[model samples]
Target: MPIKTPDAANPCVFISAEDVGKVGTETPQELAGDLGFLSNMEMIRQAGSFRMGVTPDIAAAKQMQSVPKVAIVAAPTDAKIQSGKVLLGTDVDLVVRMISMQQPHRAVPITGALCLAIACRIDGTIPARLARATLNTLTLSQPSGTIAVDANVRYINNTPVALSGTVLRTARLLFSGLVHH
Candidate 1:
């Protein structure tokens, strides 16, 4: 069953390793390697469409509808960090990369991070399987440094429920401007 917050405006979609094959042919590790040299967001979008077995139009529509935030949670792989200064440690449980229609194709937003944290706590998802016992937080290793999310999951009748998730983000006010449409 796909778990979603009942009243969420844009609910997160969690795809496990097994079900990921239904959505995309390439795994997260494979996509990471293929995306190594590509900088164009359009090309990345096309690749994602091909892997997900959807036309560009259909993918766009789906991104607008059912699953806006799609994440692939897989077992950790040896990936170069953002600076190329260091490789990720093997202790990292799972690596996640999200694709969304509302933001840049390659960027990981706070919503994606929170979704991954919630997915990590769910009982049967790949992330939950790979997650280590780390108290109440799940550490996600992205291209940048690790992001830690504080998750509180409560279970009712043996089903897990996500009560709340929190992630600390650092942002700078780049340019405050008004857009005149």
Candidate 2:
């Protein structure tokens, strides 16, 4: 199922662990600071490979040129969420991190949050494996804080085929003036 943001701009498709190469890889004893970033890059590369009908080796050098060159990953249990606004409680089922094509790859965008929440409900996805069974709400532990999303999953033939998710995020306009470049 594809997850689209409220603006209908960013569309995300969930990929399986096998596709992302997380199936046979050993779970790291400790998640290095850049582990998620590296993983996300790899996922992006893999997606690019699939899109271009090539191997990851060739895609690694050219993945950055691909459209929608970004990826998000669900953080494992060991990784900690560094945020002062919200305390990390036991209810945190998933932690989402965004990796983009630009610098400062790590981020916690609202769209990514919604996508992660929806992905959690889908079976066989990385987020689904880590997510706890919930009726509708999912608390995604991001770097900034936790985002709560209301999601509904529709099943077909015992498989998730569609998802509807909504999240309320507080956005403040820091600066709104036109700038001369």
Candidate 3:
């Protein structure tokens, strides 16, 4: 589903689980590097995950207007990357984790929403713990906390359609600078 008002921040982008590129592992340093300063995506460890020694790059959260489209998921084999943290990312239009550098590990709801949407799809593309909890509600293990995203896909002759696409995102926010004073 697409965002209304172009001012909201839930469901940043939607893509089928099977559409992501090959998966990859992220080094602790890599996940902590300066990212999302505007374009580069990065992660912030959950408060619980961070207590186990996950470090977040607070410096990278610059004045950039774009939120991340990246994700750090927990595949079955990805129980722990460092300390007690599970940081597995995909070549998704993923949102690098929107973890805050400090506090309760605040994260944007859209990331959790996006991730849960991927796992809850009817397709079996993502085989993981999160993928198994699709009874109705999905519990997303975000760095800050857990979030649940409910989705409904309208099938026209068995084909899934993206209602809003990315036009609103680019046209209203990303491209605002080009057209706005």
| lDDT per model vs. reference | 0.55, 0.51, 0.34
lDDT of 2 at 175: 81
lDDT of 2 at 177: 86
lDDT over C-alpha atoms for residue 20 of model 2: 47
Every candidate's CA RMSD: 9.2, 8.4, 16.6
Report how far residue 128 has shifted in candidate 3, in Å: 8.6
Better of 1 and 2 by lDDT: 1
TM-score top scorer:
1
- For residue 161, model 2's alpha carbon misses the true position, in angstroms, by 2.4
- Compose the digit string of candidate 2's lDDT tens values, residues 1-181: 1232231124344444344454211222222234674556656655654454443354453543432434434443433444334434465666554444433223456665666666677777666875666775777655555678766677888967545668866689898787799
lDDT of 1: 0.55
Task: Give per-model TM-scores.
Answer: 0.59, 0.57, 0.37
Model 1 over residues 103-132: C-alpha lDDT tens digits?
323435777777677767778766687666
Q: Which candidate is the best by lDDT?
A: 1
Better of 1 and 2 by TM-score: 1
Decide which is better by lDDT, 2 or 3.
Answer: 2
Instruction: Kindly report which residue pairs in candidate 2 clash with one another.
Output: none
